[model samples]
Target: MAKERSIPAPMANPETEPFWAAAREGRFLIKRCTACGKAHWYPRACCPHCMSEATEWVESPGRGTIYSLSVMKRAPEVYAVAYVTLEEGPTMMTNIVECDYDSLAIGQAVQIAWRPTAEGGPPYPVFKPR
Candidate 1:
């Protein structure tokens, strides 16, 4: 059987194209608001906090703590999805890798890692124990 493809392609948009481009180059980014000194994720055109349109893309520290997680045991094989709260204040949904499924726990420290795709899309960011 062939491996499943998971990477996502870049979306051509004025607000988020740069983000995808950078990710393709093996970088992770988060949106930071200059006016309000706040950071956000999912790449928005404006700051959700202060409603400021002045925002810039900044590289994430890529370090976070696992806020929550769930383990899968069925047809999908074994996998874990976690809500990681980044040190910089953004929570992202990512898969936890390089660790045993039974060893995962809430509040565990993890770091971002990239998973390249054969389909030529932007690398998917997953987490591993720090």
Candidate 2:
């Protein structure tokens, strides 16, 4: 059965406000360091690679491949969590939704899916098999 997991609202500070704002519009975002030219997962003011403050926000295609996954059958609700390596580069920890948990496999292509916030904040990114 495909069940919906209870998604909590994400809190946003100044550094992550833009990300949350874009999420509300159903867009996925990642940070790219202008100096190092490497994209990073967590949005921050500075680049983790070159320690450069010259970073900019770039919209992700929201496509990725599953690096690893685990199904939490012991939880109150069954769900799958995974490290999805985004097409942009960085791997993000996220949930896999809208599919049979047993059907997921490593290297499977997936696309971003949004789970709306119950607290009326920005939606969160999840992945569904493509």
**Stretches of model 2 off by over 4 angstroms after superposition:** none
Q: Residue 89 in candidate 1 has what lDDT?
A: 93
Q: What C-alpha root-mean-square deviation, in Å, does candidate 2 show against the real structure?
A: 1.3
For residues 7-117, what per-residue lDDT tens digits would candidate 1 score against the true structure?
555555878788778878878889999999999987988899999999999998699999999977665466788999999998989888888779999999999888876
lDDT of each: 0.84, 0.91
> How does model 1 fare in lDDT?
0.84
Model 2 scores a TM of 0.94
lDDT of 2 by residue, 4-39 (tens): 677778878999999999998989889999999999
Model 2 has an lDDT value of 0.91
Indicate the residue-level lDDT of 31 in model 2: 99
Report the error of model 2 at residue 57, Å: 0.3
Question: For candidate 2, which ten residues in a row score worst on lDDT?
Answer: 1-10
